[model samples]
Target chain A: MVDPKLLNFDTLSVHAGQHPDTDHGARAVPIYQTTSYVFRDVDHAAGLFNLERQGHIYSRISNPTVAALEERLAALEGGVGAIATSSGMSALFLAIATLMSAGDHIVSSSALYGGANNLLATTLPRFGITTTFVNPRDTDGFRAAIRPETRLVYGETLGNPGLEIMDVEAVSAVAHESGVPLMLDNTFATPVLFRPFEWGVDLSYHSITKFIGGHGVAIGGALVDSGRFDWTASGKFPTLTEPYPSYHGLRFAEEFGTQAFLIRARVEGLRDFGAPLAPQNAFYILQGTETLGIRMQRHVANTRAIVEYLSGREEVSWISYPELPDHPDHDRAARLMPDGCGAIFAFGIKGGRQAGRKFIKKLKIFSHLANVGDAKSLVIHPASTTHATMSSEQLEKAGIGEDLIRLSIGLEDPDDLIDDLSSALRASRK
Target chain B: MTELLVRGARVSASCGGREPDPSLPLLVFVHGAALDRTCWQLQSRYFAFRGFSVVAVDLPGHGRSEGPLCASVEEYADWLAELVEAAGYHQAHLVGHSMGALITLEAAARHPGRISSLTLCGGAAAIPVHPGLLSAAQNGDDIAYRLMASWGHSRRSHLGGHPTPGLWMMGGSIRLWERTPPGVLASDLAACDRYRRGREAARQVGCPTLLISGSQDIMTPNRSANPLRNGIKTLAEVTIEDAGHIMIVEQPDRVIDALDGFLTGL
Candidate 1:
């Protein structure tokens, strides 16, 4: 069903989520900053409350702007449905809460984001749910970690900072054998680069704070269900098949069909947590999403240029960008992220930590900041900054060496960036 | 107000600066020869927000610190070590721009135990003493300003691209080189001339180091950076393509990138 003339990323990005408003003639999705929607009468309220009709009840449960974002993200990721949340962490929490309960377990990747790592490693244990972290690329490790009580096998499509590419199909095979759905965090890769659902993942999540927003102006997250996992057939997901007393004995799988997991996450998780995305933030993210395809294209191109420049420099000790010919993951990055691996990468300084600090002091164009995925170029020393809280063992496991520097390539002319780096290196050496 | 005497001058003891997050590392900024501690205004604020304990000091004779300009780089390194120790940063991310870069390298070499990382900006291992420039300064032809103006910027740079000059004076001590004493200026330049830390010192630095230079830096030209660059066993270099020597003023963004990459990696 692919139309050769119509199939392009740019076209999809702009038109994917657009639809005309039937009543108000509003071209743009209006920010429905509403708390509760009034029902026509007692009978209408009863029908809505009893799951007899589809309508918004409260902003915490759903909103027009957020719904548009959810629909757009779901379409972008080719998922059946999506749920928006206050932050990426909240999206993860909702995803896990919807599928598992006390005594359930998860097998996750060791290279997850710091916040996600903390959640899975420390926080989830309090609720009697535990997670086993394995090497991201080790399919056998995932299989070994899964127990009968394991509800999901999770990994980031491209792990945070480390940029390890997970073999989705391999991991999914191990998960399916245990009747556990494979959940993937598509945050770093975004749907534009790698859609995990197409690679056998049953669910996907995004921390829209990074590349998805592009501008670094808003914070939001989303959970998208692929609708391929059969909860009734699995039997392990009793939460979807059994009657839920919270929603008037409604069985999600029986009632929602392909949208069971997503609906459950929204109605059960977001409804209870009250971690709904603000209408303003949702609108901002939607704006960013519209130009994502092009932004990512430039980001990748710029990244490749910087990586090549840094690799050739005599003062640079090492470069960890996967696109480089010398990189260990060069073949894998090319296969999975052929357009480009990403705009971000890690490189070690020749002078180690001291030279790193010097080089940073001399840079003229690149901004030293914690946030990534801005329209501008960014840099940070992970060992002394973001990963300072992590122990040396933890840092090494994440591939964050003391001398490693992370650079997020922006859309500027690559020559300018290279020149800036070249000058910074020259100044640093003195 | 306990003032520690260094080189027979009273300098404010490095007081614990702000909120202390035990996990976060400490950063000590050493200003260039002409500029005082306040040259690091934007950096101090930015790094502090990111959760680092930042301490910047007025070099001798430049700000409130008491001392005469001594024609020796060793004394400068000694003073820097004193400041680092006083700040309670036994080991720190030492960020040195231009003249500060030379001081930072020497200090790291003399007291290797105190520096966790080194960032050198617009600096050189050996600054060739220009005969004409040296004569001009000795003759009181106001050569320091002319040389500084050249080193401080590229012809294409505009003040609008930079944050206000007032931002450069946020810290308690700041004196744009134009206002600094003539003897102090001469002594600073003489100290740079005598300053020969060489490849051995760069090799001796035990921690990670980053080398940053400006493409248009005529003061410490790109070619002169080899000694420091080649000496270091491990180094990463970031060159600001369009920027000149005065990187802190000209291209704060690129400087920020190098800082972010180096700091985060650490």
Candidate 2:
């Protein structure tokens, strides 16, 4: 009976959620590719359906391979449980759908991934749910925005593209003061850099498509529950505290206790939404997670080297990496993410949008993609791509400048990366 | 959910989705230290739907029940006896786990006629608390939770393949402990430590007793239950392999099977 708390993060990343296959003794997690499981008998089948026992019945609800990923993510995040989804967007949507009903509201950071912004501002409004967006740095703004109908307060660990650090502890305090749970999108920081739960966050979701799945192969997401929120105490979340008619009047909080939220997300959200991660994708993501610790260390180191290079370059006008003393959130980032401020940052070129385009076009080592957290370096000019539709004034309001070029540093040799950027910088200036 | 007024405190119990029927046999589930009725979710629901009435209780000051913590196992036993009667049961088949096993033993010994049968899961004749663990819990340090969760579960459970799909057993256990109010764990540990009349209680219990042990239970190994096995004249025993102290969640199905077989025979 060894104490598992003694196991370190790197060790858990490798061995947390899987054991060798009993049937074939396979060392790697076997992909249980089947869609359904056969029951032992009629009684066993009944027991499973009624929640009288624990086992998988359908792949959409749960699968052995997917379960392994779910458990591993839960362990890594220090969460009680997790649910894996087909994409990062689905994980976000599932949580929202499970927690919010028609006539409910959310308080969110104005700076968010474009997809998330659209989901909260545009799409969910069609479903009768509204959002109030505030600056991630404004802790008081979050509290002031909370309505009696507000059920959740949300933000990214590091604001998307702008590199603004969220004061998680202060904002989480505001959320809890108003009797709402603080939720964080931890796609940029991953648990290696910042564990949101330890900073008073109640729930966190990740785009496993990013850092966790370091290689740019799989597109998946996961939502983790810290299981510290008391749903019944607030009486705001009837979906969890009251009887759920969908599952034979089972009261999630009563029967599952701290696990109520994640259980409801899986049993109802996945059952209806039907956006489960494929077993093959889960296997790929699991493999990526095994090397997460080492990969993140290199990613942070390489990012530091690039930030230093960009700071001294004649073709660069400004930099937004938080570790730089001039960045507005430098002190906050140092406190929250002492290891490193993560691998993604933004900087301004000597020229504007055209220079940004030229610099991206000339780069040989960095791929020009609308994504971050890949093993290979990635460069995206948000003004001409993700935020291209925004007017100059709108871009400024959102903290994205026309001259801003976002860089997601990778595991490549620093010298080769610096050389590639140097040639591209010269081309952009000319 | 059912609420009963026992000794002026509001006691909460899960009735397993059905109201107690006077004509049906009664099953009462008691959870271990720092845990609640949710631990008995599977077993209680199974029996509740299968021709029996179930009451999985949250002991005073635990879960939904309101209280100043019970100071000793004998006090908790007396409270349980009152709760059973308040729920309109004359006799019940009591099922207890770890600290809960001690409570059931004391209850059966004190009021022999009220308990029809006994099932002690992870029971021991004596439980001696570690001084360091007691101090840690007394100060409300989270290390107490980590130690219990890591040691309570078998090694295989750490790499979770939970019967409940997508659940991390060890992580869930820690979260459950975190939900308990401060000082409750220390109080429960103290009560378990102070309990010293297991052999006398076992000798006095005339009900058909079943002793369920986990093969890998380091917290309270099978050998520790030797006094109960020897004292209880009509005792039957079952050992679940590869299970640790918290077998109720670690290997729920096996624990259920053992209970189902034993209760059906009785």
Candidate 3:
């Protein structure tokens, strides 16, 4: 049998998971606005509910409009399957819920977003799952942290705010040797700049609200399975390897093979958690994904120019970017994501905390906001905003500095963004 | 939802539960050439719920089943004979697809004691491999996988509307075939091509048999499947329209309903 030709990524971005509605002859993906689908017959309805067939029974489980976005994202990432969630936070939670239950553990990078850090350290323990946070730089710590109960090794392609680079290939080796999957958060790098799956990371997720969505308008996330992990071989994840009593004695691994993890995440996690992506939001993300590659290229190009401008300024006390030659993980980032390190990173101001706030307040064009990856530039002071409730020790442990100002470079002209930063720096000084 | 290690062959299967219920009839599902047991997902889940203990086997050396690749369809059949006993079942109702069907046909004929019956979905009395396709698999060319997957499904499947809501059936099938380890596909294709005993073995089989053929199947058209009807006694044929070789996915509901109905009658 000859194989069907697959369109390249750029082309797939435009067409991968969609086709014209044969009945309606609509050119664009119609919003499957309804919550339920009409079954052809009683047997057909039973077939869908029992997972004997693959049609949508309910929007909360799977919807056509959202399925289009999910399939497109899965194609873009080269994953076997994907489950779209309400937000990146929900995606991570869904992944964890699918892989483990009470008594299981995870080893994660200490350098993480505040919300993730809290979820791992505090919130999840209340649910009986626990985490061991490790320094991403200590490659050995990842291996050493593995316990018999450890189900996954977690890291980000680019650590939030700090831009700390996780050695994916190196960490993946540790994870595989320990017989657990490695899940990476690739929101910052996106697939255009980096794909953790290529480095042997078994699963990856994105806050599509960021690069994949390319706009801050939609708050959604996606979890993708590389279809590479062997749960039965590992003999650790009973969740995937054993029949779920709640789901009618259905065994995910036996039923879905390589895609067992993702199947369970959708069948159990999304169904029970009820954090399904709205069809409207899914369309918004789909529109953004269509031009992800081009937008990311422009964002990276503008970012490098802005970083260069900031590095030469007297008002900047220090600049932290993996692209900087002197950065600790510069070589590693270059090897893993040659396209770019990321569009968001942190920098320290010469005048410290008070001046850092003034500089952000002084920017006219760059909006001071909590979100990132918008077409318009944005700035945030993590210590006062995302991490305000944390104590000094907690903030320091997370690598968040009082003087650090985080910038998420946008698609604006590089010179305009640079000029705005230049004026803000001058206004905040003496 | 657990791993079952078949003794001696070191072959493993993804089983539906921690332990197979002895009182229940065992349904062993084998995959097509260059594919894994996951292809039978819809059937396995449905059968498991229908009071059958299911085990989707990753043929020796494919998927999770560590392989010293079985040299021929006969060898694979012999291995299944042992896997049934090793899996602690008195006998198994064997279901195979494509290359797997050839193996099941041979096993039921040779080791009838370990097999309850046979169900061949998308199989024929003889399979002739395209020379270029065989050459591609031999070279471990990924193009061979794509070619096989593209031709495996009907044109309607190319623009997919799988019963499953979100899956791009064609893309999923391509990715599945691409996961075959080095020489597995080449060996599997050669085994199917060289197997000369399918029609002869069907004549020797002393059990009920079912064939679910796709009306639009280009790989094993009606002409290819006709010889089987002449060879087997008490045989049944159910044809699903608008489906190709991969009818299990292209028209999963129809394929599944046929099996469910046949088993219920049995």
Which candidate leads the pack in TM-score? 2
lDDT of 3 by residue, A232-324 (tens): 779998888766887677767766877778778888888899899999999999899889999999999999999999999998988889999
Question: Which candidate order results from sorting by lDDT in descending order?
Answer: 2, 3, 1
Candidate 2: regions farther than 4 A off: A1-5, A388-394
- Give DockQ: model 2: 0.62
lDDT of each: 0.73, 0.90, 0.84
Model 1: which docking level applies? incorrect
How do the candidates rank by TM-score, highest first? 2, 3, 1
Query: Could you tell me the fnat of model 3?
Result: 0.40
> Pick by lDDT: which candidate is best?
2
- Which should have the higher lDDT, number 1 or number 3? 3
DockQ, 0 to 1 scale, candidate 1: 0.00
- Candidate 2 lDDT over A42-81, as tens digits, reads 9999998888888899999999999999988888998888
Q: How do all the candidates rank in terms of DockQ, highest first?
A: 2, 3, 1
Off by over 4 Å in 1: A1-9, B1-266
Cα displacement (Å) at residue A410, model 3: 1.5
